[model samples]
Target: MKYSIIISFLLLTVCLTAFGQEKQSRKSKNPNSAAAEKGLIKVSVMYPFAEGKTFNMEYYETKHMPMVAGFLGSNLVKYTIEKGLASGIPNQPLPYMAVGTFYVKSLDEYQAAIAPNRDAIRADFANYTNVAPVILVSEVVR
Candidate 1:
Protein backbone atom coordinates (compact mmCIF):
# COMPACT_ATOMS: atom_id res chain seq x y z
CA MET A 1 0.00 0.00 0.00
CA LYS A 2 2.81 2.43 0.90
CA TYR A 3 4.63 1.64 -2.39
CA SER A 4 1.41 2.32 -4.33
CA ILE A 5 0.92 5.68 -2.59
CA ILE A 6 4.51 6.68 -3.37
CA ILE A 7 4.04 5.73 -7.03
CA SER A 8 0.80 7.69 -7.24
CA PHE A 9 2.41 10.77 -5.69
CA LEU A 10 5.28 10.58 -8.16
CA LEU A 11 2.86 10.40 -11.10
CA LEU A 12 0.89 13.39 -9.82
CA THR A 13 4.09 15.41 -9.45
CA VAL A 14 5.18 14.54 -12.96
CA CYS A 15 1.81 15.58 -14.37
CA LEU A 16 1.91 18.89 -12.52
CA THR A 17 5.44 19.61 -13.76
CA ALA A 18 4.47 18.85 -17.32
CA PHE A 19 1.42 21.08 -17.10
CA GLY A 20 3.48 24.01 -15.81
CA GLN A 21 6.04 23.57 -18.58
CA GLU A 22 3.36 23.52 -21.24
CA LYS A 23 1.81 26.68 -19.90
CA GLN A 24 5.19 28.41 -19.93
CA SER A 25 5.86 27.33 -23.50
CA ARG A 26 2.51 28.67 -24.64
CA LYS A 27 3.19 32.02 -23.01
CA SER A 28 6.57 32.28 -24.67
CA LYS A 29 4.96 31.68 -28.04
CA ASN A 30 2.84 34.80 -27.54
CA PRO A 31 4.51 37.74 -29.33
CA ASN A 32 3.56 40.27 -26.64
CA SER A 33 4.57 38.04 -23.76
CA ALA A 34 8.18 39.27 -23.62
CA ALA A 35 9.34 42.88 -23.82
CA ALA A 36 12.08 41.91 -26.23
CA GLU A 37 9.38 40.69 -28.60
CA LYS A 38 7.87 44.21 -28.72
CA GLY A 39 10.68 46.02 -30.47
CA LEU A 40 10.45 48.74 -33.08
CA ILE A 41 9.98 47.81 -36.75
CA LYS A 42 12.07 50.30 -38.67
CA VAL A 43 11.50 51.17 -42.32
CA SER A 44 14.81 52.40 -43.64
CA VAL A 45 15.21 54.39 -46.89
CA MET A 46 18.64 55.14 -48.37
CA TYR A 47 19.30 57.66 -51.13
CA PRO A 48 22.41 57.62 -53.27
CA PHE A 49 23.01 61.09 -54.70
CA ALA A 50 25.09 62.08 -57.70
CA GLU A 51 28.24 64.15 -57.50
CA GLY A 52 27.86 67.92 -56.74
CA LYS A 53 24.55 67.03 -55.09
CA THR A 54 25.35 68.40 -51.66
CA PHE A 55 21.95 70.11 -51.81
CA ASN A 56 20.35 66.68 -51.46
CA MET A 57 22.19 66.03 -48.24
CA GLU A 58 21.16 69.39 -46.85
CA TYR A 59 17.52 68.86 -47.79
CA TYR A 60 17.36 65.65 -45.82
CA GLU A 61 19.18 66.90 -42.75
CA THR A 62 17.63 70.37 -42.70
CA LYS A 63 14.17 69.84 -44.14
CA HIS A 64 12.92 66.25 -44.33
CA MET A 65 14.18 65.05 -40.95
CA PRO A 66 12.49 67.91 -39.15
CA MET A 67 9.15 67.58 -40.95
CA VAL A 68 9.00 63.83 -40.38
CA ALA A 69 10.06 64.14 -36.77
CA GLY A 70 7.30 66.67 -36.17
CA PHE A 71 4.79 63.93 -36.87
CA LEU A 72 6.61 61.13 -35.05
CA GLY A 73 8.08 63.30 -32.26
CA SER A 74 8.84 61.47 -29.02
CA ASN A 75 6.30 58.76 -29.76
CA LEU A 76 8.95 56.85 -31.72
CA VAL A 77 12.62 55.98 -31.28
CA LYS A 78 14.89 56.77 -34.25
CA TYR A 79 18.36 57.36 -35.71
CA THR A 80 20.02 58.39 -38.96
CA ILE A 81 23.37 57.51 -40.59
CA GLU A 82 25.00 59.43 -43.47
CA LYS A 83 28.13 58.47 -45.44
CA GLY A 84 29.86 61.32 -47.34
CA LEU A 85 33.58 60.82 -46.72
CA ALA A 86 35.79 60.35 -49.76
CA SER A 87 37.55 57.00 -50.39
CA GLY A 88 39.98 58.42 -53.02
CA ILE A 89 38.47 56.19 -55.77
CA PRO A 90 37.55 58.60 -58.61
CA ASN A 91 34.92 56.34 -60.13
CA GLN A 92 33.22 55.36 -56.91
CA PRO A 93 31.41 58.35 -55.41
CA LEU A 94 30.21 58.52 -51.81
CA PRO A 95 26.44 58.86 -51.89
CA TYR A 96 24.10 60.59 -49.48
CA MET A 97 22.01 58.31 -47.29
CA ALA A 98 19.47 58.71 -44.46
CA VAL A 99 17.18 56.41 -42.48
CA GLY A 100 13.86 57.44 -40.91
CA THR A 101 12.35 55.26 -38.20
CA PHE A 102 8.87 55.15 -36.68
CA TYR A 103 7.71 52.82 -33.92
CA VAL A 104 4.11 51.67 -34.05
CA LYS A 105 1.90 49.36 -32.02
CA SER A 106 1.85 46.80 -34.82
CA LEU A 107 2.74 46.15 -38.42
CA ASP A 108 -0.69 47.40 -39.46
CA GLU A 109 0.06 50.90 -38.24
CA TYR A 110 3.30 50.91 -40.18
CA GLN A 111 1.52 49.82 -43.33
CA ALA A 112 -1.29 52.31 -42.96
CA ALA A 113 1.05 55.28 -42.57
CA ILE A 114 2.96 54.45 -45.74
CA ALA A 115 -0.01 53.63 -47.97
CA PRO A 116 -1.51 57.10 -48.03
CA ASN A 117 1.56 59.34 -48.04
CA ARG A 118 3.62 57.25 -50.42
CA ASP A 119 3.38 59.74 -53.26
CA ALA A 120 3.92 62.79 -51.08
CA ILE A 121 6.99 61.14 -49.64
CA ARG A 122 8.53 60.42 -53.01
CA ALA A 123 7.73 63.95 -54.04
CA ASP A 124 9.36 65.32 -50.92
CA PHE A 125 12.69 63.96 -52.11
CA ALA A 126 12.07 65.02 -55.67
CA ASN A 127 14.36 67.59 -57.34
CA TYR A 128 17.09 66.49 -54.91
CA THR A 129 18.70 63.55 -56.64
CA ASN A 130 18.39 61.86 -60.00
CA VAL A 131 18.97 58.37 -58.58
CA ALA A 132 16.16 56.86 -56.57
CA PRO A 133 16.95 55.94 -52.94
CA VAL A 134 17.04 52.37 -51.73
CA ILE A 135 14.35 51.69 -49.17
CA LEU A 136 14.73 48.71 -46.84
CA VAL A 137 12.56 47.76 -43.90
CA SER A 138 13.82 46.07 -40.74
CA GLU A 139 12.75 45.19 -37.22
CA VAL A 140 14.67 45.58 -33.97
CA VAL A 141 14.41 42.05 -32.63
CA ARG A 142 16.56 42.71 -29.63
Candidate 2:
Protein backbone atom coordinates (compact mmCIF):
# COMPACT_ATOMS: atom_id res chain seq x y z
CA MET A 1 0.00 0.00 0.00
CA LYS A 2 2.84 2.42 0.92
CA TYR A 3 4.83 1.64 -2.26
CA SER A 4 1.73 2.18 -4.37
CA ILE A 5 1.09 5.58 -2.71
CA ILE A 6 4.69 6.68 -3.21
CA ILE A 7 4.65 5.72 -6.87
CA SER A 8 1.39 7.58 -7.37
CA PHE A 9 2.79 10.70 -5.71
CA LEU A 10 5.93 10.66 -7.85
CA LEU A 11 3.90 10.24 -11.02
CA LEU A 12 1.67 13.17 -10.02
CA THR A 13 4.70 15.41 -9.38
CA VAL A 14 6.24 14.55 -12.74
CA CYS A 15 2.97 15.23 -14.51
CA LEU A 16 2.61 18.63 -12.79
CA THR A 17 6.19 19.60 -13.68
CA ALA A 18 5.69 18.70 -17.30
CA PHE A 19 2.44 20.62 -17.36
CA GLY A 20 4.12 23.69 -15.89
CA GLN A 21 6.91 23.58 -18.46
CA GLU A 22 4.44 23.27 -21.30
CA LYS A 23 2.41 26.20 -19.96
CA GLN A 24 5.54 28.35 -19.71
CA SER A 25 6.64 27.51 -23.20
CA ARG A 26 3.25 28.43 -24.59
CA LYS A 27 3.24 31.74 -22.67
CA SER A 28 6.75 32.72 -23.69
CA LYS A 29 7.03 34.78 -26.83
CA ASN A 30 9.24 33.65 -29.72
CA PRO A 31 12.38 35.81 -30.11
CA ASN A 32 11.65 36.15 -33.82
CA SER A 33 7.94 36.82 -33.38
CA ALA A 34 8.19 40.39 -34.61
CA ALA A 35 10.06 39.40 -37.74
CA ALA A 36 7.75 36.46 -38.32
CA GLU A 37 4.70 38.64 -37.93
CA LYS A 38 6.04 41.11 -40.45
CA GLY A 39 7.26 38.22 -42.61
CA LEU A 40 10.89 37.41 -43.40
CA ILE A 41 11.98 37.56 -47.02
CA LYS A 42 14.67 35.52 -48.73
CA VAL A 43 16.26 36.37 -52.06
CA SER A 44 17.94 33.57 -53.92
CA VAL A 45 20.15 33.93 -56.98
CA MET A 46 21.18 30.86 -58.95
CA TYR A 47 23.90 30.87 -61.57
CA PRO A 48 23.88 27.88 -63.87
CA PHE A 49 27.00 27.23 -65.89
CA ALA A 50 26.75 25.75 -69.38
CA GLU A 51 29.05 25.21 -72.36
CA GLY A 52 31.52 28.08 -72.85
CA LYS A 53 30.24 29.88 -69.69
CA THR A 54 32.60 31.05 -66.97
CA PHE A 55 32.43 31.74 -63.24
CA ASN A 56 34.87 34.06 -61.51
CA MET A 57 34.71 32.85 -57.92
CA GLU A 58 37.64 35.02 -56.90
CA TYR A 59 36.08 38.25 -58.10
CA TYR A 60 32.67 37.29 -56.71
CA GLU A 61 34.04 36.51 -53.25
CA THR A 62 36.51 39.36 -53.07
CA LYS A 63 34.69 42.19 -54.80
CA HIS A 64 31.04 41.55 -55.68
CA MET A 65 29.88 40.15 -52.32
CA PRO A 66 31.69 42.87 -50.39
CA MET A 67 30.03 45.53 -52.49
CA VAL A 68 26.67 43.86 -51.88
CA ALA A 69 27.32 43.78 -48.14
CA GLY A 70 28.22 47.44 -48.19
CA PHE A 71 25.08 48.29 -50.08
CA LEU A 72 22.75 46.22 -47.88
CA GLY A 73 24.47 47.25 -44.64
CA SER A 74 22.23 46.67 -41.63
CA ASN A 75 19.22 45.72 -43.72
CA LEU A 76 20.88 42.46 -44.77
CA VAL A 77 20.26 40.20 -41.80
CA LYS A 78 22.34 37.37 -43.20
CA TYR A 79 23.49 35.82 -46.49
CA THR A 80 25.04 32.60 -47.73
CA ILE A 81 26.88 31.55 -50.88
CA GLU A 82 26.97 27.94 -51.97
CA LYS A 83 29.20 26.45 -54.64
CA GLY A 84 27.53 23.53 -56.34
CA LEU A 85 29.56 20.37 -56.21
CA ALA A 86 27.68 17.56 -57.98
CA SER A 87 24.17 16.44 -58.71
CA GLY A 88 22.47 13.75 -56.61
CA ILE A 89 23.07 11.24 -59.39
CA PRO A 90 26.59 9.88 -59.58
CA ASN A 91 28.78 11.18 -62.44
CA GLN A 92 26.33 13.96 -63.16
CA PRO A 93 27.37 17.59 -63.41
CA LEU A 94 25.89 20.14 -61.04
CA PRO A 95 23.00 22.07 -62.55
CA TYR A 96 24.01 25.28 -60.88
CA MET A 97 27.48 26.75 -60.59
CA ALA A 98 26.62 28.86 -57.55
CA VAL A 99 23.68 29.86 -55.41
CA GLY A 100 23.31 32.89 -53.17
CA THR A 101 20.69 33.33 -50.51
CA PHE A 102 20.02 36.66 -48.82
CA TYR A 103 17.83 36.95 -45.75
CA VAL A 104 16.19 40.29 -44.99
CA LYS A 105 13.69 41.48 -42.41
CA SER A 106 11.13 42.31 -45.07
CA LEU A 107 10.58 42.62 -48.80
CA ASP A 108 10.26 46.38 -48.48
CA GLU A 109 13.67 46.66 -46.81
CA TYR A 110 15.25 44.53 -49.52
CA GLN A 111 13.61 46.56 -52.26
CA ALA A 112 14.68 49.84 -50.68
CA ALA A 113 18.28 48.72 -50.40
CA ILE A 114 18.49 47.17 -53.85
CA ALA A 115 16.65 50.01 -55.61
CA PRO A 116 19.44 52.48 -54.95
CA ASN A 117 22.23 50.06 -55.86
CA ARG A 118 20.59 47.98 -58.59
CA ASP A 119 22.63 49.43 -61.42
CA ALA A 120 25.93 48.95 -59.64
CA ILE A 121 25.02 45.39 -58.67
CA ARG A 122 23.96 44.54 -62.18
CA ALA A 123 27.15 45.96 -63.60
CA ASP A 124 29.26 43.88 -61.23
CA PHE A 125 27.76 40.67 -62.69
CA ALA A 126 30.04 41.08 -65.72
CA ASN A 127 33.04 40.79 -63.41
CA TYR A 128 31.84 37.39 -62.25
CA THR A 129 30.05 34.62 -64.19
CA ASN A 130 28.91 34.90 -67.79
CA VAL A 131 25.77 32.87 -67.05
CA ALA A 132 22.67 34.93 -66.35
CA PRO A 133 21.45 34.39 -62.79
CA VAL A 134 17.91 33.29 -62.00
CA ILE A 135 16.53 35.29 -59.08
CA LEU A 136 13.73 34.29 -56.72
CA VAL A 137 12.16 36.12 -53.79
CA SER A 138 10.17 34.14 -51.24
CA GLU A 139 8.57 34.67 -47.85
CA VAL A 140 9.74 32.50 -44.97
CA VAL A 141 6.74 30.77 -43.46
CA ARG A 142 8.63 28.61 -41.01
Candidate 3:
Protein backbone atom coordinates (compact mmCIF):
# COMPACT_ATOMS: atom_id res chain seq x y z
CA MET A 1 0.00 0.00 0.00
CA LYS A 2 2.82 2.39 0.82
CA TYR A 3 4.57 1.57 -2.42
CA SER A 4 1.35 2.08 -4.31
CA ILE A 5 0.87 5.50 -2.70
CA ILE A 6 4.41 6.55 -3.63
CA ILE A 7 3.97 5.38 -7.21
CA SER A 8 0.63 7.17 -7.46
CA PHE A 9 2.17 10.44 -6.35
CA LEU A 10 5.09 10.10 -8.77
CA LEU A 11 2.86 9.25 -11.71
CA LEU A 12 0.45 12.07 -10.90
CA THR A 13 3.26 14.58 -10.65
CA VAL A 14 4.77 13.56 -13.99
CA CYS A 15 1.43 13.59 -15.74
CA LEU A 16 0.45 16.97 -14.30
CA THR A 17 3.79 18.54 -15.27
CA ALA A 18 3.60 17.29 -18.87
CA PHE A 19 -0.07 18.10 -19.24
CA GLY A 20 0.30 21.61 -17.84
CA GLN A 21 3.22 22.43 -20.16
CA GLU A 22 1.40 21.10 -23.20
CA LYS A 23 -1.82 22.96 -22.43
CA GLN A 24 0.07 26.17 -21.70
CA SER A 25 1.98 25.99 -24.99
CA ARG A 26 -1.16 25.26 -26.96
CA LYS A 27 -3.11 28.05 -25.23
CA SER A 28 -0.36 30.53 -26.09
CA LYS A 29 -0.60 29.49 -29.74
CA ASN A 30 -4.41 29.71 -29.82
CA PRO A 31 -5.65 32.08 -27.16
CA ASN A 32 -9.27 31.54 -28.12
CA SER A 33 -9.19 27.78 -27.80
CA ALA A 34 -10.16 27.80 -24.13
CA ALA A 35 -12.76 30.48 -24.67
CA ALA A 36 -14.43 28.40 -27.39
CA GLU A 37 -14.77 25.48 -25.01
CA LYS A 38 -16.41 27.58 -22.29
CA GLY A 39 -19.91 26.56 -23.29
CA LEU A 40 -19.19 22.84 -23.15
CA ILE A 41 -19.42 20.80 -19.97
CA LYS A 42 -18.26 17.35 -18.93
CA VAL A 43 -20.25 15.08 -16.68
CA SER A 44 -18.28 12.22 -15.21
CA VAL A 45 -19.84 9.33 -13.32
CA MET A 46 -17.13 7.43 -11.52
CA TYR A 47 -17.52 4.18 -9.65
CA PRO A 48 -14.90 3.88 -6.94
CA PHE A 49 -13.07 0.62 -6.41
CA ALA A 50 -13.81 -1.40 -3.30
CA GLU A 51 -13.10 -4.98 -2.26
CA GLY A 52 -16.66 -6.19 -2.76
CA LYS A 53 -17.93 -3.79 -5.41
CA THR A 54 -19.32 -5.38 -8.53
CA PHE A 55 -19.39 -3.89 -12.05
CA ASN A 56 -20.96 -5.47 -15.10
CA MET A 57 -18.96 -3.97 -17.91
CA GLU A 58 -20.96 -5.83 -20.51
CA TYR A 59 -24.24 -4.23 -19.39
CA TYR A 60 -22.65 -0.82 -18.82
CA GLU A 61 -21.11 -0.72 -22.29
CA THR A 62 -23.85 -2.42 -24.27
CA LYS A 63 -26.97 -1.15 -22.49
CA HIS A 64 -26.61 1.45 -19.72
CA MET A 65 -24.49 4.00 -21.61
CA PRO A 66 -26.51 3.56 -24.73
CA MET A 67 -29.69 4.33 -22.82
CA VAL A 68 -28.07 7.44 -21.35
CA ALA A 69 -26.97 8.61 -24.77
CA GLY A 70 -30.43 7.99 -26.10
CA PHE A 71 -31.94 10.04 -23.31
CA LEU A 72 -29.63 12.99 -23.89
CA GLY A 73 -29.93 12.77 -27.65
CA SER A 74 -28.83 16.03 -29.35
CA ASN A 75 -27.90 17.53 -25.99
CA LEU A 76 -25.00 15.14 -25.70
CA VAL A 77 -22.03 15.78 -27.93
CA LYS A 78 -20.23 12.56 -27.07
CA TYR A 79 -19.87 9.91 -24.36
CA THR A 80 -17.23 7.41 -23.36
CA ILE A 81 -16.73 4.53 -20.93
CA GLU A 82 -13.46 3.53 -19.31
CA LYS A 83 -12.35 0.44 -17.42
CA GLY A 84 -9.66 0.76 -14.77
CA LEU A 85 -6.63 -1.51 -15.07
CA ALA A 86 -4.18 -0.46 -12.32
CA SER A 87 -3.57 2.10 -9.59
CA GLY A 88 -0.15 3.43 -10.68
CA ILE A 89 1.72 0.44 -9.22
CA PRO A 90 2.10 -3.11 -10.43
CA ASN A 91 -0.43 -5.50 -8.91
CA GLN A 92 -2.09 -2.69 -7.00
CA PRO A 93 -5.86 -2.45 -6.81
CA LEU A 94 -7.45 0.15 -9.07
CA PRO A 95 -8.71 3.43 -7.63
CA TYR A 96 -11.87 3.29 -9.69
CA MET A 97 -13.57 0.29 -11.18
CA ALA A 98 -15.17 2.26 -14.00
CA VAL A 99 -15.79 5.77 -15.26
CA GLY A 100 -18.29 7.16 -17.70
CA THR A 101 -18.25 10.67 -19.09
CA PHE A 102 -20.39 12.83 -21.29
CA TYR A 103 -19.20 15.86 -23.21
CA VAL A 104 -22.36 17.89 -23.59
CA LYS A 105 -23.04 20.99 -25.63
CA SER A 106 -25.39 22.52 -23.06
CA LEU A 107 -25.60 21.86 -19.37
CA ASP A 108 -29.12 23.21 -19.10
CA GLU A 109 -30.35 21.03 -21.92
CA TYR A 110 -28.64 18.02 -20.45
CA GLN A 111 -30.20 18.65 -17.06
CA ALA A 112 -33.63 19.14 -18.53
CA ALA A 113 -33.42 15.79 -20.27
CA ILE A 114 -31.90 14.03 -17.29
CA ALA A 115 -34.34 15.36 -14.72
CA PRO A 116 -37.30 13.59 -16.24
CA ASN A 117 -35.52 10.27 -16.55
CA ARG A 118 -33.47 10.49 -13.38
CA ASP A 119 -35.46 7.86 -11.56
CA ALA A 120 -35.18 5.38 -14.39
CA ILE A 121 -31.47 6.03 -14.61
CA ARG A 122 -30.98 5.57 -10.91
CA ALA A 123 -33.07 2.44 -10.96
CA ASP A 124 -30.91 0.92 -13.64
CA PHE A 125 -27.76 1.50 -11.62
CA ALA A 126 -28.24 -1.86 -9.89
CA ASN A 127 -28.26 -3.64 -13.21
CA TYR A 128 -24.62 -2.74 -13.89
CA THR A 129 -22.80 -1.74 -10.70
CA ASN A 130 -23.32 -2.22 -7.01
CA VAL A 131 -20.97 0.64 -6.12
CA ALA A 132 -22.47 4.09 -5.89
CA PRO A 133 -21.35 6.54 -8.53
CA VAL A 134 -19.46 9.72 -7.85
CA ILE A 135 -20.65 12.55 -10.01
CA LEU A 136 -18.70 15.56 -11.26
CA VAL A 137 -19.83 18.39 -13.46
CA SER A 138 -17.20 20.72 -14.89
CA GLU A 139 -16.83 23.20 -17.67
CA VAL A 140 -14.52 22.19 -20.48
CA VAL A 141 -11.30 24.20 -20.46
CA ARG A 142 -10.06 23.18 -23.89
What does candidate 3's lDDT look like per residue over 41-89, in tens digits? 8999999999989999999999999999999998887889999987864
- Deviation of model 1 at 126, angstroms: 1.7
Spell out the clash pairs found in candidate 2.
none
How do the residues 45-93 of candidate 2 rate in per-residue lDDT, one tens digit apiece?
9998687889988888788887887777787877888888866444457
Report clashes for each candidate as comma-separated counts: 0, 0, 0
Candidate 3 overall Cα lDDT vs. reference?
0.90
Q: For candidate 1, report its TM-score.
A: 0.52
Please give, for residues 1-142, the per-residue lDDT of candidate 1 as tens digits. Answer: 8987787678767867998999889887885655643576666666555654433667777787666555454544555646455423333456544444455445566666556767766787764555576777676674
Candidate 3 lands at a TM-score of: 0.74
Q: Is candidate 1 or candidate 3 better by TM-score?
A: 3
lDDT of 3 at 140: 83
- Give the number of the best model, judged by lDDT: 3
The pairs that clash in candidate 1 are none
Candidate 2 residue 109 Cα shift, in angstroms, is 1.3
